[model samples]
Target: MNRYESMMNHLLVQFSNTKVLQAIFCAISDELQLLDDTFNNLKEKRWIDTGEGAQLDGIGEIVDRNRLINNAITINFFGFENQINTTGFNQARFREYSEPYLSSTSLSDEEYRLILWAKVNKNNSLCYMNDTIKSIQFIFKTDIAIVQDIYNAKFIVGIGRKLTKNEILFANALDLIVRPAGVSCQSMTHFDKDNVFGFYNQKFAKGFGQAPLSEIFSNNLIKKGYVV
Candidate 1:
């Protein structure tokens, strides 16, 4: 029922529905409706999951104050545009690089919200190794493991399945951004069930070329993101 109808029902039995009272109730109902709408908007638009347009932009600014990031590059579903190879012509011809690539397409509100929340969660991290893993996990919504090589000052992130073109881009950029200073990171995917390349022997002295020395699959290792 509308506010006016509810107001009329609340009156005593002796009171009549006069024209003057109806006019006053109609005015009051209009004002109350506007107030109710404003409050309802606040309830729906306050969070990232339900926010849209200006509300999503406001949330982005809160986490990414510097505005160093662009939605086009991060959230674009299409591949990079205007790509130029600095090396020989073969570079990036049959292969792709995770370098700070650009995108020409626009990102939808939902896509923007997803990436924004991932960055926000990463920014709020405590810089611990587990936090780093968790941040990456939040992005892909999958289980992954990180191998830390403290001696070499590097780490290897392993995912079980293959990542799509767009996912590879996001994963590469995220790894570089969240990595610690002076440390390197690499993303590896499509691992075997055994987690090793070949079988072992009693002597453990297999020949150098006995098994596959390099990665078994293509696009298994995505290099770190390039700043330039």
Candidate 2:
């Protein structure tokens, strides 16, 4: 067997080790049989690669495995065996579903979010900045002042708003905006003269900026605002 196949076999063993199937259904239960059928079907498909760098192939295999697991969970635990439907199976797939789409060279969500949030908030210079707040929150360590500064400066007004020194330091530490070495600025405006914001805007703005904040920032600020 190739490396991918070996990995799939390992995963299959891990799934069975959970013993979730046995716990959820009697040995001869129809649900158990369904689970067995799903598992054996996956094994028979020989879709998994037992080698390194087999992420793409593994995704399909892992997804099939999770599907079987979820089916077993839903039927035996949730007592939804009668409602065995495949309509929403996609959501239960593993995180590896996105592995193929990612690149080793790509900046992490944290890095991308920091860059986009800094640019949008700086360029628009608009209060009531409803978007990209979550990106800011996720990229930076959770600091209430930093969040409030970005929010109140652009979202809410007449609220006696200012970013604390610590918050400014934190934002600066992200280095989302490139600046000359040893230069210091408390706010984004200091870098505006050289179009520093524009520089970052051009580099990190595409794809990263456009991605859904929920995916990029771990919070759905837009949905929370009813922006849809």
The candidate scoring highest on TM-score is 1
Q: What is the C-alpha lDDT of each candidate?
A: 0.54, 0.31
Q: Which runs of model 1 end up more than 4 angstroms from their true locations?
A: 1-20, 65-102, 174-182, 190-228
Clashes of each: 0, 14
Tens-place lDDT per residue, model 1, 37-98, is 78989998878898888787788778873223332243222224322222344333333455
TM-score of 2: 0.18
**Overall local distance difference test of candidate 1:** 0.54
- TM-score (C-alpha, index-matched) for candidate 1: 0.61
TM-score (all chains, Cα) for each model: 0.61, 0.18
Any runs in candidate 2 off by more than 4 Å, and if so which? Answer: 1-128, 143-170, 173-228
lDDT for residue 217 in candidate 1, whole number 0-100: 16
Judge candidate 1 at residue 102 and give its lDDT.
49
Q: What is the lDDT of residue 128 in candidate 1?
A: 72
